[model samples]
Target: MQRNGPIALAFHSLVVVFMLAPMVVVCLVAFTPENTLAMPWNGLSLRWFKAVFHHADFMSSFGNSVRLALLSATISTVFAVPAALAITRYDFRGREALNALFLSPLIIPHLVLGVAFLRLFSLMGMGGSFGWLVATHAIVVTPYTLRLILASLTSMDRNAENAARTLGAAEWTVFRRITMPLMLPGVSGGWLLAFINSFDELTMSIFVTSPSTVTLPVRMYMYASESIDPMMAAVSTLMIALATITMIILDRLFGLDRLLVGKG
Candidate 1:
């Protein structure tokens, strides 16, 4: 493997700092004692963090966001597994089309999808329902799960599966015992990716969310529209922390570098 030259290393460091600077600022602002999102803090404080829980809308929305992300990610993974299997294991009509359909959301603008979903659900009289939001989120996140699992499947050796079958192991037994265990890392990584995307989602969520189904990101947008405060920073900081922790857990369990580099 070739090592990065000094120029490449410097460029990478600068890019990383550029990307992280906003998050660092937000984390710092979250500790500001002042009410506004201004610099030169009057001393570090946790008041805004405390205020985050006190705000009724934010609290409720945070819970809703958590539930939505979990459900969407799990469901997406369940659906993705089978689709990925079909794509990688069998030759069938529309296989390419099916893969394309699964990945369509990535190419299409999210705002357009949001409008389409809104209009479709309205016609079905299911507009603004929690289930409606979950379904949409699953659709958007499925491709991530499918791609991850497909990568895992494509890289998997067929010898184990063949050996199991030759030993009279049923198809389900081979899958449940052999394939699934090997695919676990991909499945887990996919779930984390979907969860992060769903949790941070705002564009499509903005269209489908009802007053009753408002998520944390949408709520944050609404609040920021009316107010400028460290509370928003606190909320952002918390979200950043949650995502960071998730990534750390993923790295510990699955070797994040291996997973991202398609070695899973």
Candidate 2:
């Protein structure tokens, strides 16, 4: 008889508990009647959630975040996928260095980029523009898309494309007809990750945002600066729900494990 794995299961359970605790706490606090967020036992009420729904500023910021995230994710995917194809399909000088350069966004501090963009926008006489925000978000989101798209390209069998070309299919036809479908999973996963990164981004968004063009994270920052209430908890809980739903949808699109941790 085979024995069950005990330590492995226990460790996995602990990790899940740890990851869930903060979200659970925030969800509970969202219903608290008290002004302060405490864990000791207090009566629960739906008042805070009601206020969160009614806030015009919150709705506006949420809409802006969605718009920017969609725009940035699409832009990043289009640019990065083509760049990834070129880098992976053809041998070029400085290949490794160029890949590193594309990934530099991950290393650079977002706050620094924020300030740089602000100064650049001002110098260009385009300060406080929505296009600037979208452009900055695309830059930030590009690396993830490139990484996944490259991996997809690597997983592909070169023989098929060679055969397609041998059979009279053009280079563009080979890519469009054979390669694109195989790479869809990675492209999709990258797009979702890019959108989430843009949605959750705060530091970079601060420098780009104006009163008329603020994202949700910026609104949350401003709100936190002024108040410490259950309303924030309600908003946080809603965000957590959205994140969970997004992950579930992504898992359905491309197996979540394979998307994040490469398949053996």
Stretch of 10 with least lDDT, candidate 1: 255-264
* Cα error, candidate 2, residue 147 (Å): 1.3
- Candidate 1 Cα lDDT to native: 0.90
RMSD values, in order shown: 2.1, 2.9
Model 2 clashes, total count = 0
For residues 1-264, what per-residue lDDT tens digits would candidate 1 score against the true structure?
146587798899999999999999999999988868875356788989999999999999999999999999999999999999999999999999999999998898889999999999989999989998999999999887787788788888889999999999999999999999998888898888889889999999999999999999999999999988999999999999999998887676566777677655
Clashing pairs in 2: none
| Total clashes in model 1, counting residue pairs 3 or more apart in sequence or in different chains | 0
Among residues 3 or more apart in sequence or in different chains, the pairs in candidate 1 whose N, CA or C atoms overlap within 3 Å are: none
| TM-score, prediction 1 | 0.94
Which tens-of-lDDT digit does each residue in 17-105 have in candidate 2? 99999899999988888777754266778888888879999999999999999999999999988788879877889988878988999
Error (Å) of candidate 2 at residue 197 is 0.7
Residue 230 CA error for candidate 2 (Å)? 1.2
What Cα-based lDDT does every candidate model obtain?
0.90, 0.87
